[model samples]
Target: MSKTTPKYLLLSLPTSVVPSHHADDALEAISTTVSAENGSAAPFSIPEFKIGTLDALVQQADELAKLESQCQGVVAKVADALRNILDGDEAQIERMMVVNDKPVDQYLRTFQWNKVKYRADKSLAELIDLLHKEGASIDNDIRFKYSQYNQVKNTLATLQRKQTGNLSTKSLASIVDPRTVVQDSEYIETHLIAVPNSQEKEFLKNYETVAPMVVPRSASLVASDNEFTLYAVTTFKKHSVEFVHKARENKWIPRDFKYVEGGKEEERKEVERVGGDERKVWGETLRLGRTAWSEAVMVWIHVLVLRVFVETVLRYGLPLDFVSALVRTPSSKQADKAKKNLDDKYSYLAGNAFGRDKKGRVQRDDPQDMHGAGEGSAEYTPYVFYEFEFN
Candidate 1:
C-alpha cells in the first residue's frame, strides 16, 4: 500500500551483491587482478567497457520502445482515418446520426488519415548522427560495437516491415490486471505472490500448508502466466509482514509496487493510466505534430544503441572466431595475374578449385578432379556452397 512497502519483495530492490548492470566494473577488477598476478600486460589488450555506457544505452532503448509502440498506435489512427474517408461505413453513419440527430448524407466533413511518419523521419536522422558520433568507429578493441549496431539496425528495419503489414497497423490489446479479482478489505491485508511456473502445481497443492505460516486461510489463486503465477494472499494487517516473509521463504515473490496508500485498485488504476490514457497523450501529440513515424524510426535507432552496448560487453572481450577462405572469381585477363598472387600467398592451403554447379552446390566428387589423390580423399569430398551477390 505504501511505496515504502514493496508490492513485490523480490523485485523491490536488488538482492545481488553487485548490481546486475555493473559487469563493466567487475570485468575491470578481474583484468587488473589477473595482470597484477602476471606482472605484465598480455600481448593484446581486452576491450574495456565504459562505466555507465550500458545503463545509458538501455535507457535509450526504453525511450525507443515507447516511441515504436506509440508510433504503431498512430499508424492505427491514420488507417482508421483513411478507412472512414474512403468507406464511410454504416457504423460511423449510424453513430453520427445518433449523436448529431441528422441524416447521414447531411454530414459534409469526413476523416483523413494523416501521416505521422514525417516527424519520426527527422528523429531517425538525428539518432543516426548521434550513433555515428558516439559509435565505436575507433578502437578495434571495441569496434565490434559497430558490427552489432548494424545487425540490430537491420533487424529493427525487418521488424518494422513485419509490424505494419500492408501499410496498416493493428493495436495490441491492453493487459488485464489480476488484482481486480480480489475483494476490498480493511482489517485483512492482501498481497500478490508471483511463483515460478516450474513449481506452480506444487505450490498450489501445498498452498494451505504455507498460508498458516503467515495467516490462516491467506492464500488464493488470482492469476497465472506462462512463466509465473500471481496469488492473492489476504491476512490480518498486523501479520502482513510475516505473510510476505513466509511467502518469500517459499519462493513466492511479492508483487513490486506500493499498495498501502490506496491498495490494489489504486495501483491498477495507475497502471491503466500509464498503459491506456497517459500513453495516448504522446500518440495524440504525434498525430498533431505529424511526426509519429519519425519518432518510431528514432526509437528503432535507439534499439540498435542498446544492441551495440550489450554485444560489446558479452562478446568483445572474449575469444573471436577469425576466418579466411579462398574466393572464386570469373576468369579474365586481370584475373590471371590476381589468381597467381593469391596462389603464391596461400600455397600452403589445400585447393579445391573444381567448378561449382549452377545451384552453387559443389559438384559430385570425381576421381579426375583430384587425380590419384581424389581416391578416398576427404579433401575432394563434395560440399554445399553459396554464392553471394553484393550490391
Candidate 2:
C-alpha cells in the first residue's frame, strides 16, 4: 500500500438493500459515492456465526468488540516489533504476512475469513473464549522470544565493542602477550599500566623507583592504542599495592590484570560462543515474530466478524439478514467522506435505538451512553462499522 492509502474498512448493512450475490450494487455505490476515485470496495465473507438468545448476545457483543480491538492493537504492536528486529525496514513486515504466495495488498483485497480455525458451529461464548486464549498465547510467545533475543544481542554487542575499543576501555586478555607476563612467581608480580604517550619516557625512566622490592629494568611495552600505551611492570607481591599508589601519583593509570596460562585462547572461545548464541536466538525470534503476526491477524479478523454478527442481531432485532463488506479508501480524507456518505444512505437503519451528535456522528441511545460507556459501547457506529489498518 502507498503511504497515503489506508487499509480496508469492515462494514455491515441490512440485506434489504444489498442482497446475496448482488453485492455489486453496494460495491458500486461505495466505490463511486463512498470512496470516490480514491479507493475500492470488495465483499468480505463472514461465516454464519452461531447466535444465542438476545440477552446473551447483548453481553457478548460488548466482550467481542473489546477483544477485536485488543487483537487489532496486538497486530500493530507485533508489526512494530518485527520491524525493529529487521532494523526498521517496513517492507520486511509485509513480506512476513504473505498469504498463498500473494503480496499483502493483493491478499487483503481478496481476503477470505478463515472458518476452519474458528468454527461457526461453536456458540458465541465458545468463540470468544477461543479468541482470548489465542491472543494471550501469541502475546506470551512473542514476549519470551523478544526478551531472549534482546539479552543475547546485548551481550554480543558488549563483547564486540571490547574488541574494537581503546586499550584503556578494552579487554586486556587478548592484548597481553603470555610470554612477557611473569606468571606463578613467589614474590615477583606483573602489573599492567596505561601510560599516556607523552609520559612514556618518564614512566620508563622511574619505573624501578616507584616502590621497594621492585624488579629492576622489568618495565616493557606491551600494546599501544590511539589514546594510551600499555606497559607491564614487575614488583614484589607484598609491595604491589604501594607500587600502584605511587604509579597513580605520577598520573599513570594501573589496570588490574591476572595472568593465566592459555588466557588468550579462553577469551577467543568465549567471544565465539556468545556470537554463535546471538545468531541462533536472533533467527528463532524472527521466526516466532512472523508466525505470531500471522496468527494474531487471523484471530483479530475472527473477532471482528463475531462483533458484526452480534451487533446485527441486537440492532436488527431478530432473524439474521445483513450484508457485510470490506471497503478500502486511499486516504483519511476519502475515509471521512466515505463515512459521511454511508451515514447519509443508512441513517434510517438506526431506527429508535441510536441518535446523532451535534456533528452528526452516530451515537447510541442506550443507558450505557448516559453513564460513560466502556470501549465496546463507545465504539458503536451507525450501520455496524469498524476500521483497521495493515502494518
Error of 1 at 160 (Å): 15
Q: What number of clashing residue pairs does each candidate have, in the order they appear?
A: 18, 0
What are the lDDT figures for the candidates, one per model?
Answer: 0.36, 0.76
RMSD over all Cα atoms, model 2: 4.7
The alpha-carbon RMSD values of the candidates against the true structure, listed in the order shown, are 27.0, 4.7
Global local distance difference test of model 1 = 0.36
- Candidate 2 has its poorest 10 consecutive residues by lDDT at 367-376
- Candidate 2 wrong stretches, greater than 4 Å: 17-24, 178-222, 231-256, 351-380
Residues 1-391 of candidate 1 have per-residue lDDT tens digits of: 3112101000000112124434344333323432332221111111222324445544543444344344334434433332333254545423422102322122111211122422223343345344333322212212233334334445444444433322111101122243533346666656666788877787667765654534455566655556666666666667667667777898867764332533445544544544453334433432322232233223332333323333333222233221111122322332333333323332222234443467754443342423111113354211111111101
The candidate that achieves the highest TM-score relative to the unseen native structure: 2
* TM-score between model 1 and native: 0.24
After the best TM-score superposition of candidate 1, give how far the Cα of residue 136 lies from its true spot, in angstroms.
Answer: 8.7
For residues 200-220, could you state the per-residue lDDT of candidate 2 as single tens digits?
Answer: 898888989878988898888
Instruction: List candidate 1 stretches off by more than 4 Å.
Output: 1-188, 196-201, 208-213, 225-229, 236-242, 257-391
